[model samples]
Target: MTDFNRDALGPPAGLVATMRLLLVEDNARLAALVSDGLEQQGFAIDRYESIDGAEHAQTIAQYDLLLVDLGLPDGDGLDLIRAMRRRGNSTPILVLTARGGLDDRVAGLDAGADDYLVKPFQIPELAARCRALLRRPGNALDSVLTAGNIVLVTAERTIRVNGQAIEATPREVALLELLLRRSGHVVAKPALENALYSMEAEVTPNALEAIVSRLRKRLAAAASNVQIKTVHGVGYALFAPPAADE
Candidate 1:
C-alpha cells in the first residue's frame, strides 16, 4: 500500500537553502563517500541498501530527490521510481545506475527519472545534477501544513482545526510548522530547542514543552486524537498523516 500526505501534494516552498536526499545505492563504500560528501555540502542524506528500504522510505519519510543505482540486489531501480509516480508522488528523481547505454538511459527516463547518470561518473557531476533537480518547481513540500485535523497557514497566521478558523499565536504556528514538516519522525529536544530559536535567538526553559501541551489540547478540542505524541526520553512526532492509516 502507498500513502499520500498533504506535504507531498502541497505547493512547493521557495528555493531551499538546504535539502534532504534519499540515496539508494547498495555499495557500502560508494554510499559512504557520497553520503559524507553531501553532508559536507550541508545537505541531509539518508542511504538505503535495497528496494524494501526504498519502499519504507516512500511512506515513512520524504525526500527532495532520490539517487538510485540501476543494479541492486532486490530489483530494478526504475521499477521503484515508476511505482512512486503511479502513486502520485512527483519528487524529482535522478538515476545513478551503472548502465549507460542509450537504451538504459531511455528506460530510466521512461520510468520517470528527471536525469540519469552512469556509475563511475565524477562525484561533482552527481552533486551538480542533484542541485539542478532541487531547482525544479514542485519538488518541495507546501509552505503551509495540516496537522491532526487542523489546517495551519503560515502565510496567514491562522489555524483551522476542522474548517473553523482561529488565531494561532506566532509561537504556536512555529511549533506546529516544525511538527508538521517532520510528521512521522520524533523530533528530539535539542532539535526542537534549536527550531524554536536560532542559535542566536533567546530561548527559555520549558518553553517547548509548554507549547506542545497547548497544541495538543487544541488538537483534541478539534476532535483529533493527539496526533503529536511524546516518547519517553526521546521527542515528539506528528503520529498521524494520510499514510498513517496504512
Candidate 2:
C-alpha cells in the first residue's frame, strides 16, 4: 500500500520559497547530509534522531511535511505514524527507509505514511517528492508572502524584490519570515526573539535590535517595497507596501 496525495511531479520550474519539514532519522550523518541538501532547496528543517524527540516536537510545532526513517532506537517509526494518524494528524509524511521490499512498503503505507522512499535515494528525487507533497491542497504553508514587490518565501528562506534575488543569512531569513507571516499585524519583540533564537542562546542586550536594523538596511538597499516598521517600545510589523501614487 502506498499513498500519493498529489501526482508524481518534480520541483517547480522556477525558484520559489519553501516550507518547513520535520525529519526523524536516527543516523546522524545521514540526517546532516539530508538536512543540508534540503536546506539548499529552501526548506527549514527541525531534526530529531529519536522517535521520542520527534513525538515531543509534534506536540508543540506544526510542519508542512514529515521525513521519517523506519527504524529508531526507541521504537519503530511505524508506531509514530500510527499514533499521529490516530490523533488525527493529517500532516503529510514521507517515509525514508532502507527497507526496500514490497512488504515493508506495504506495511508503512498501511500504518499511515503518505509517501515512501527507499534509502540510497538522490537528493533531487527527495526534493521532488517534497515539492509534490507540499503541492497537495492544504498540505503546505502559504508558498509566497508578499508585501508589494518584496516577497518572502518562508518555506524557501528566500527574499526577492521585483523578481530579483536578495541574499539573506539564515537568521535574517527566519526573521523576515516571521515579519512577513504577520505582515499587517504587530509582532512583539519578545516573540520575535523567541522565534529567531532558541532558549539556550546567550543573547546580548539590543542584539535583536541590531539584527532588525541590519535587515531593514538590506531591504532598503534592495529597493524592496515592504518595510519593517518598529514601534519603539512595541514590536515590529511588516508595513503594507506604499501606494502607487505615494
**How many angstroms is residue 174 displaced in model 2 relative to the true structure, after the best TM-score fit?**
36
- Please, what are the lDDT tens digits per residue for candidate 2 over residues 1-246? 111121123333444444778999888889888977887676777788788888887787778899999898899999999999999999999999999996998999999998999999988689878877887423333567677787777667788988898988777777888787667678999998997677356667887898888898988898877778888899999886556823
Candidate 1's C-alpha lDDT?
0.74
Let me know the TM-score candidate 2 reaches against the reference structure: 0.50
Off by over 4 Å in 1: 1-16, 136-246
Reference-based TM-score of each model: 0.49, 0.50
Point out where model 2 deviates above 4 Å.
1-17, 136-246
lDDT of each: 0.74, 0.80
lDDT of 1 by residue, 43-102 (tens): 667788788888898687778888888787899888888998899889999998778886
Which 10-residue window in model 1 sums to the lowest lDDT?
1-10
Task: Report the C-alpha displacement of residue 77, candidate 2, in angstroms.
Answer: 0.2
